[model samples]
Structure formats: C-alpha cells, structure tokens
Target: MKESIISVEGLSHKYSSSWAIQDIGFEINKTGILGLLGSNGAGKSTTMNIMCGVLNQTKGSVFINGIDLRKQPELAKKEIGFLPQQAPLYKELTVDEYLLHCGYLRQLDKRMIGKAVDEAKERCGLTHFSKRLIGNLSGGYQQRVGIAQAIIHKPLLVVLDEPTNGLDPNQIIEVRSLIKEIAEERAVIFSSHILSEVQLLCKEIRMIDQGKLVFSDTMDAFNNYVAAQSIRVEMDRPPAGEELLKIEGVTKVEFLTARSLKIYFDGDHEVTDRIIKTSVHHDWHLREIFFDKNSLDEIFAQLSNYTKSVN
Candidate 1:
C-alpha cells in the first residue's frame, strides 16, 4: 500500500475557552487534492494552521511524511509548503528577489537556490515579471507569487487556504488551473469555504461545521449521501395540482408561480422520464426540468444527523 503523505490524528485545538476543532483526523496520500470545506469561522483556518505547523495544536498529532510535525518541525516542514488566506509577500521587492528570499527561507542549498527560484517562477508564470516589483503586480499575479513561494522548495504537500478568494473570474480560472498542475505530482490541502469551489477541484472533501468534522469522503460519496430532495420544472402550459398528483413517485408538488413548479420525489428512478412523458401526453409544454442540488447548509445538516446516528 502507498504511504500517506500527511497524517493527522485526533487533532484538537482551543482558543482560550472554546475549542476550534475537536478530534479532527484524516490522511492524504502523496497525490491529488483534498478539499477542506467549511463555512466562515468554522475552524478551517485553525485546522490548516495546525497542519502546516504555523500553530501548535492543543492536542493530537500531525505527521508529514512520517515525521511528527510538532516534534520534528524543521525536518517535516521541509516536505510541506503553506500559503495561508493572506499571501505572505514583500511587495517592495522584485518578484525574482522575493522568490530568492523565499528559497533561502525554505533553507534550500545555495547551489540549488537559483535553479529552484527559476523553476518556481516558470511554473507559476512569473518569468515575465521577474524584475517587476511584487507591489506593482496585479492581484492575480500577486496570488501567483504567493503560490510560487509555496512551491519554491518543491515540498511533497502544499497547503493553500482559499487561494482564489480575492481573484476575479479570469484569475480564479488561472489559479485553479495552476492548482491542478501542482497536484499532479504531490498532495495538496485546498481549504475553502465555497462549496462549489470544492466540488469543482477536489475528488474528495472534508467538511467541518461548528468545530467538528461532520463528513469525510469522496465527492461522489457526498453526492450520494445527500439524496436530491426536489427538482425544478418550468412549463409553458402547466397542469393543475390534481392532474400532476396522478403521476407515480412524486410525493409533493409546490407551485412557485403560474408556470414554474417544484417536484418532490421519493428516491424513485426514472421520475424525470415519467414526468417528461406525462408532460408530452397532456401538452403541459415542459420547457426544462432538472434536479435541485442540495445547498451547503442542507448537506451540513444531513451529515450532522448521520454523524449523530453513526455515533
């Protein structure tokens, strides 16, 4: 079996009297991205901070590449790169100078520092801005510099907390593409509060709510866990409630407007096909029909219940 790149066991942290995270544990192998998901102030940052050795956990252990993070921080951190929500940058320095500084901070050999900085710059598309002051770079390029520094040491794992938080749509796309490339050869912990962002980038997701890990599984498993409860249907010539109730598998029908309705199902297969056929037969003029994705809050509630039930 392949060894895990990072292992977190029974991790817990307290800020004064309140616990920020409790008994949080998970492991990631040395490839692919794991999305750490939560709402704002849901302990996502606390967890990332502890895992990246920025803060000491009040309890439990974090092992990066089989080395204890708290015990052998210097050695273990050699295999981990971290970019927190706020980019750590010296805006006054040129991109090249800043990257060279990061290389030294990461403790790279003097002989390898130049090559490492160059490679990191190339990988992050910062070669053109090598001489430009980081302070003068756009928000997107600044984010790139942040990411470049994270990878400057070529760590086995990279922890990024909301890398796309402040970027525009175009910049978000660019950073996402860069993340994809970075994860190809190493493990990455991508922390974000945005549910859609996690859905788009990660194959697996870990959801934290109210200082607890409520769900930890693959994205496919998460989708399966939360069964779609309703579907939205728009019709031109809509049918009455009495007429629609005659269909199979539909438990409830809520009309939002004269032409739009919400249909609730009881886990029945082919409900859409049946609805489509009925619409054609009755000339209800079905314009569009699609299942409504469960909201993040709804999913959190469901997972909370499951966690309670299993425990």
Candidate 2:
C-alpha cells in the first residue's frame, strides 16, 4: 500500500477544564478527498487545528507527510495547507496583494512569489479577479481566494474546515468543484456537518461526535451500515397499507401519496425482498424503490450510543 499522507494517532486536546477531543486517530491517503464529519462543537475544529499546527494538542501525535507536527512545526507546516471555518482575508487588499502576502507567509523565496501567486490564482479560477479587492468580490470568489492562499505554497495535504458554510447553493456547488479539482493531485481533508455534501464528494469518512472518533469507514460502507431501516417505494398499482404490513420484519407504513409510501422495518433488510415478491404477486407494478438513509440526528445518536457501549 502507498504510504499515508496524514497520520494521526491517539490525538487529543483539552480546552480549559474540559476535554475537547479524545483518542481521535485516523490516516489519510496521498490523493483523494477524506471528509471530517461532525456536528458543531463536536471537536472537528480542534482536530483540524491541531493537525494543521494552528492549535496544540495536549496528548497524542500528528504526522504530516512523515514529519512530526509538534516536533518540527516549521517543516511539518510546509507540507500542510489549511483553511479554517472562516476564510482569512484582508478585505482592503486586492486578490493579487493578498496572495503575494500569503506566499510570503508561507516563506516562499522572493523570486518565486510572483509565479506562485499566478499559479494559485489560475488554479482557483481567480485570474480575472486578481485586481479586485478581496472585500469587493462575491462570497464565492472570496472563498476561492481563501483556497488560493492555502495552495500558494503547493502543500501536500490541505485541511479545509467547513469550507462551504453560509454560501448560496450556486456558490457551494462551485466551491465543491474547486475542492474536487484540487484533490486530484494532493490529499484534501474536507470538513463539514452536512451529511449529503460528504456523501456526494468524499471517498472515505472519519466522523467525530461528542469529542470522540465515533465512526471511521469508507463512504460505501457507511451508506450500507446506516441505511435500509426505512425505504421508500413508488408503485403504479399499490396495495392497501394493511396488506403491506403483513410482511415479516415490517414495523410501520407511512403513505406519502396514492401511489407511493414509505416502509419502516425492524432489522431484516430481506424485508425488501419480501416486499418485492409481494408486489409482484399482487401486480403492484413497482416503479421505484430505494432505502432511505436515516436523518443526521438519527445516525449521530445511534453511533454515539454504539461508541459509548464499546467503551
């Protein structure tokens, strides 16, 4: 297997008297998008901050591309590019000026600052906005500038914290595309509380809850593990709600429309197969059927309970 790009082991942190994150550990591959998922105040920020060397961890370790973050802060930081939840921008500065400043902050050679700034601007679709003041640009463009600064030094691992927060739908789409494009060459850690965004863009997921690593797995596995307790089916010729309830493992039925309904099951996913068979027998003419993943609250609660039980 290829060596990991980001390695975190027993990573932890405390704020004042309370633990913010505890025993969080995970690894990122060299290329692709990995989602750091959690609710607000779930310690996602603390973990990202520690990994990016912006905040210190009280216990554990973070290794960025094999360099110990805490031991060699400068060297380790050279391999990382970070965007906190809020985009750091000097509103008065034009895109060009801000990027040049960032290049300096990254300690790029004076001779390379211009080239690096241009390249970052081009990659982030900010070439045309180079002369525009950071505050004058739309929220989407400002976000692009933030991303541009993060990549000015061309780091190996980019950690983004809630990069899509508070953006219009169109802006969010544009930013998501930019992130995917960026990940093609380097590892990207996209953090968000939105489940659908992670489901749509990530290859793997590391979920934190109540300051602990509650779930870690591939995206497909997560889909399968959390879904199927409920399913929505649309049929051209549907049966009465009572008739459908006779199937084993079925718990409840919710009618959504004259031709559609949602089915809730206890545990046996085979209940879907049975429903299919029954539909065929009754000539219900099933048109569409798919399992519905639980709501974010449901998944969080379920995972939290499981984690506590394991501990």
The C-alpha RMSD of each candidate to the native structure, in angstroms, is: 3.4, 2.4
lDDT of 1 by residue, 161-199 (tens): 999998999999999999999999899999998888898
Q: Write the per-residue lDDT of candidate 2 for residues 1-311, one digit (tens) a residue.
A: 55579999999898899999999999986699999988888899999999999998999999888889999999999989999988999999999999999999999999999999999999999999989999999999999999998999999999999998989999999999999999999999999988889988998999998899978998877766665588899999888889989989888999999998999999788998999999999999999988887765577667878877886
How far out, in Å, is residue 137 in model 2?
0.9
Best by lDDT: 1
Best candidate according to TM-score: 2
TM-score of each: 0.87, 0.91
User: Any residue pairs clashing in model 1, and if so which?
Assistant: none
